[model samples]
Target chain A: MARGSTRPTSRDVAQAAGVSQAAVSLVLGDKWRGRVSQATAERVREAARDLGYRPNLAARNLRLGRTRTVLLVVPALTTEFFAGVYTGAARIAAEHGFGVVLYPSPEGIGPARDPFASAQSALDGVIASSMAADALTAIRGEALPLVMLDSDPDGSLGAATVNLDIADGIRQAAEHLLSLGHRRFLHLAADVPSWTFEVRARELAARLDEVPGTTVRTARSPISIEGAVTAAQAALAAPGDRPTAVICDDDQLAAGTYKAARRLGLRIPDDLSVTGVDDLALATAMDPELTTVHLNAELFGERGMRALLAVLEGRAPESGDIPVRLVLRGSTARAG
Target chain B: MARGSTRPTSRDVAQAAGVSQAAVSLVLGDKWRGRVSQATAERVREAARDLGYRPNLAARNLRLGRTRTVLLVVPALTTEFFAGVYTGAARIAAEHGFGVVLYPSPEGIGPARDPFASAQSALDGVIASSMAADALTAIRGEALPLVMLDSDPDGSLGAATVNLDIADGIRQAAEHLLSLGHRRFLHLAADVPSWTFEVRARELAARLDEVPGTTVRTARSPISIEGAVTAAQAALAAPGDRPTAVICDDDQLAAGTYKAARRLGLRIPDDLSVTGVDDLALATAMDPELTTVHLNAELFGERGMRALLAVLEGRAPESGDIPVRLVLRGSTARAG
Candidate 1:
């Protein structure tokens, strides 16, 4: 069939068969007991087969008491990172006959006491990104089956957890920086205390600490370009030895650092080597581009959606972290 | 009162007053209806005021049997255009104690036949962006209130419409191009059959046709960078005469058109000028910021939500198109 060919409903089949649509629904839903006559059910089934009539989902969900809808709570909507995850999760959920509703909890922008109030459908389950912990204050202790993404994996709180292999990403980044013979590092961490960023910070510090003669300086910034510029400027302005390599928590931050480097008369990878997490479109859009972690947000979304469906179906969540890989770009190089 | 303020609940007030939560709900809800004694109602009211209690929205909505939730059905999550609309709509909705649920029917990224099924709550009304017309086809005939955004002003199917001043935006763009001594224009129109795009093509042609010796070469492209590139490339490759200005339907398409010009060794505003509708973040982020029409997606969204809310309240929708403005950035200049 071509695109937009047909989405024939059971009612269409019923009309063709000259029977009540309920008879087609019963036969298709496989609940045709004493209600639907055997001959009539067969005729309805045959007509439905010819018409490609799928049952009306709204009516089915209403009768089934569960809509197979999962609510995904996130911190913000600006970044494609979360959007990718949503797309990925939704893909998986669709395969299993589930729908995902994304709630970019208003708390990240300001104060949102309850994100669920916006996701009007009564949920069969929930998949929440750990970035929005403030919104979770209302979500905790609810009987809703929950799955946590990019959170403290060990701190399960009895909920299923999905995470990126951020440790590996950090390790790859640190190793690349260290291999470049960089003795000093500046870790521009996000000011937000998310487990994902925490992992980057801790792992970076630990890796550099292992190098006897290496030094690491820390600075905080909000996950934005301007914030990163300010934070990087201050971190670089110290009256001591300047760091040779700058590692940022996100591409947006890296973009800011790019401006900050330019302002400081620093050319990326020449005066300072910069690395970023989340290989966003902006990373590539940057003039010199950026070396960053390729977080498969869409795949992450697909996995999260799949995990929630599994939980709803009384199945265990798929184990292991969603692996993240570093994309080598022009932004990072040997310390000059 | 900063960041995480303690919000008082009516139940908390009731417990403090040694009264049932129902008494508190009734008194605060202003629906005692002989359920509570006048003296008890007074006690509940005083306790509520003393405790600074406010009724939770869920309970309030439940009591009213009307979920003050608006389902916003956008065609996509791919671009920031609809995202801004959602933000705008949501901001307006929040002021009235209403919540907005994104209805991702087209995303069919999930298996749910109806997008609202995943939102979990039944909506009192809906606001749909033009992109979701096919998805809206299934939902349009429903009893729920609906408001169409950026849809056909005339063919609103009896639903109230909140349209962008698209025709005016096109007219302004053409006039701006014309004023700059640009007689030849490439109408980089969206390939979709939607009414909004039709307006762009019609209005641009009509406005250009008004001026003697003015010419418009129409080129169709899907609303994507790649689609725009291919279409723009073909349009520019045409023999003999070439348009000095390209008017794109949206920002992403404009960005693609820029790439097409670069491939053909054309410089923006000098060799060829381009203007886009929907001043997305990409507008500024582009190399030469997009000279485009500022289609107020957020205002369109806000108005759509407001209209839907008004319809649900049995009130007339706000009449007339939401206005759009031309944002002249670096992408266009006086024809040399």
Candidate 2:
């Protein structure tokens, strides 16, 4: 399979199907709605599949004058959260004959200063995730097909938006925690000012406001375990009805909360309840496994890639917000 | 920068530098030695740099009839270690005006599957990391320039080999534990049969064997926190003075050891001492923080890329293993 010879091309598919090369192109191009009959189109698709006829990206790029490579602009690739998103997106991009190139917008160097000059070469579109809208001004130029993932759908700056059902996920978390008879709550929210986090803040507030006597306090951490520990420790030490339930922005934050509780002589799900988002590998690694929202990072990436592919083909994205679910584990329980 | 005009070429650089186009090409092409005088070459380079010139990758590929892109064959991209290698290699390649395209071997997907079928491009070379040499027979047919990262340099396949100073790193770790009066050690080794982990096992055993009264225990885990916890717990529970120190192959494994110690009523740097490698963010997140070896991921990437570039340009790479150092945090102390 790894021999140096070039792969069988679309022309090979045309010959195998005994159809005109143009017919093969039109059917495989997904542009034969009225030009070719449905039955004939299906024949071309079957033949292409049987012959294992992959498209020649170089030739198609030359003909169309646009490389089908989408630049996925992410904040960082070091974490499992973002890496999962990248994995999902790359898989989907691969399925549809498009290449996904990553641009981790210049950590310590900032995106505007050193965007991948090579990434700009022959890019068909871009999908930016968890980035400041203004930070994307460079990519937003020339009305490139842009899809924002997990960013503000309402306030996206000239880009199509695809997002997890984050507000609903928060609602689910609130319901799960509250159903356990917890009232006093501490939201271990991320200190970031991004819109996705804002959704968590607003949704948690709104959901808690429904119950009279429910109190919500907040602590901000820089989305790391140590940061979450320091912030959560101070938040839990405050003089008030101690929050029985703690909901964190991500699994790493949850791990920090675990440390904070240990220092304060509080035990998870017994003395203090905790929940986390982004069910990263860190969740189960905790002494008492963290209860967290399972944000399908790979699915998120896949959906983002699908949306970009939609934009590239001049078609609308297929559906609504991608689904997310809560995975209840060892970290939450009834009010004391 | 997105001006929709043909980017300034080498001809433009020659005019700007007030030199013949051939002189500019010779200097900018990194072939200035003996072909052009030092002063003239410096002037040409400065002019090209000031203009933010990039040699057109497409045109060069056409002229050479080979893509300047090198295919990186790895087992998977979902792994942090491999991702780190990719980051390291890509950074170095960018500096030398080469591109890296990843070709993750689809394990369990059978030999009928070839990565190049989907990637659909020819390459100037290949740099393989963490792949079985025997399984790479199909890939060996290309006769392309090749560099191996973290592969065995002895039964090797590539033209050049680059690796982290793993053996030395393990020695430093063992010596640190020994100096701290830790005679009984538990090696929380990764179950993967890769050469890198083998180096860790071999080096640690060798170092400890040299120290009188040293005792070593071994456990194999699947490189996940849960797997590490199970393996470490079983190992720690076994007899022989109940080893007070644990040396893990990676940061994630160290984290698991932390939980296992806590479960076994041991505290960090107190009843049990722990150490790890690859200083992941998890190291700093734990309550006591973790002491680990700082394998410079970016530098590793930069070196691999530089090596690939050198091979591409017919130059010699910087020799020897990239060194690693111990980042002592709060995870380990004297065996009490």
Candidate 3:
């Protein structure tokens, strides 16, 4: 029992407590209520604590055919939105005696590495974001249970899907802008070809199509403030009737649009109106607080983990998309 | 092998290749240079691929007393800084046939959970951020190779430390502001009681003390835009002569300072000047791009992982701090 020599085993605890190995197993496993006396169980527990005994979980999990660990695959962790997602997912995972490992697939760097090889843990299940589709081929090679978040339900190869109601959120944004007397519009789309971004484009177009004299021009940019600024500035300065409203793919894009507006001497809500999705901290930090769709990232992550857990347990995952809301702020007003 | 029946074992691969189990082991373990013929090794590899056989890394690693995996413990994943760190660490780890699992210790949520219990992997070592001090007690209980990132080298209990040259960065910032002829200053400090933030405060105070006719005040705020707005506004509105310059602990606080200045009808660089640390993307997004310190977060992470690897190999870690730079942007100017 010398410090740092080796981890004490259950047998060491039993020897220290003067109890049989079987009694130690039963008590430590929490299944000794009927067989072992209360006093003996307490003594065994005390011995284990005194010896700093820790069960070899890796060996035990291998024998049990479960690792009690899942992999949460994300596109990248560069923004607080995904961080919120991981936080919510990890909280739920801890409650269920499961640990969540993150695998952020390399973005446009190269072919995706096998997550199982990279995670180095025998995973019971996987929860993946659709934005990380580059890693799907490698993941599909394995026969583990999986749940897709922010994915197209009809295209996930029969995997359960947990998605925020992004289409509905887009509809709400469009309705709010249309009600504010906006007609000319510029859609600052994320250049990534993910199903979630596709939904944003599709829903916005559909909602705008319902109104007459509504014209929407599309500009694609990488999901970054710098990239958005370049794309937005070019589109806004094009030789034509300038769009009075800009609907950004996300808050970062909206922040860039604000910069673009500044360069063009267009004041927010006075000369132009802007709206964005995913009310990240940057949303409020803008000169005029962004009018954005507040998609609860933590709740999205919670539902994703819950769906993954259900899939692993041989049960049907909950159906229906999580709802989102439009938050009106200074960034939007009657079109000038 | 039938699809989804069971994972094909090395034995199945040997049988399919018509070779002895020992030959398969030598070939797959990459120890067959002299023992097995090249043709036979190629045949065995093809059989493994054809049968979809994967080595049981968990069981093999258990027997070898190594998991080829490490844990990265951070305070939170809510910022791009830590995300950059993880990316760098993971890149190095992958190159060495190792995997990294992140454990963002619960922030202010209660007692810390043992990362070993939650990661559920037999980790070979750990790379921890000092901001996550709450988890240090749990980590210290286990005997493992440890590396500290952004920690006080003198106070890490003998753990190897990797840090940015925060003190030098602060000196440069202070010199820049002082050269602009600022005589009064306000330090907008992060409320977190971590060694890195402490370094900023100490270095800034030490630098400003050398100059005559200079006075400074301090205000504390949580490292968020909203919290900074409240803190900066009150500090700026104090009854005494208002400080002509503000130096924030980080970029988020600087963004909040911009808002506070706007609320008080003060123009940046004209009515007041500002400086910050951590030149995040938000720095350039601000109307007047922030003058701040640029800490290479990815390099810090890479160095941390390299140090942990060196410790695991019983070698001395690389010494010296990673360098940082002061980026001059539009946020600062000569006091008006």
Instruction: For candidate 1, write residues A190-270 as lDDT tens digits.
Output: 999788888888888887788899888999998767678789988988878999999898887887787787778887888
DockQ of 3: 0.60
Docking class of 3: medium
Report the TM-score of candidate 1, chain A only.
0.86
Q: Pairing residues by index, what is the TM-score of model 1? A: 0.80
Q: What is the TM-score of chain A alone in each candidate?
A: 0.86, 0.80, 0.96
DockQ values per model? 0.21, 0.20, 0.60
Best-to-worst DockQ order: 3, 1, 2
Candidate with better DockQ, 1 vs 3: 3
* Model 2 alpha-carbon drift over 4 Å, by segment: A1-60, A64-68, A109-116, A132-135, A157-160, A234-242, A261-271, B1-127, B131-140, B212-215, B237-242, B261-271, B333-336
The 10 consecutive residues of candidate 1 chain B with the worst lDDT sum are B1-10
Query: Fraction of true contacts kept, per model?
Result: 0.24, 0.16, 0.57
Backbone clashes in candidate 3 total 0
Candidate 2 or 3, higher lDDT? Answer: 3
Compare candidates 1 and 3 on TM-score and give the better one: 3
Worst 10 residues of 1 chain A by lDDT: A1-10
In candidate 2, what are the lDDT values of residues A1-336, reduced to their tens digit?
A: 323565567787788887899999999878998999998888888988776565654465545656667777776555667666766776777667666666655543323533435342456788887654444766654356788887876677646788899989899999998899999999999987778899999999999999998999999998777789899999999997799999898887888888888889998889999999988877877767778899888788878888888877889886688888999888888888
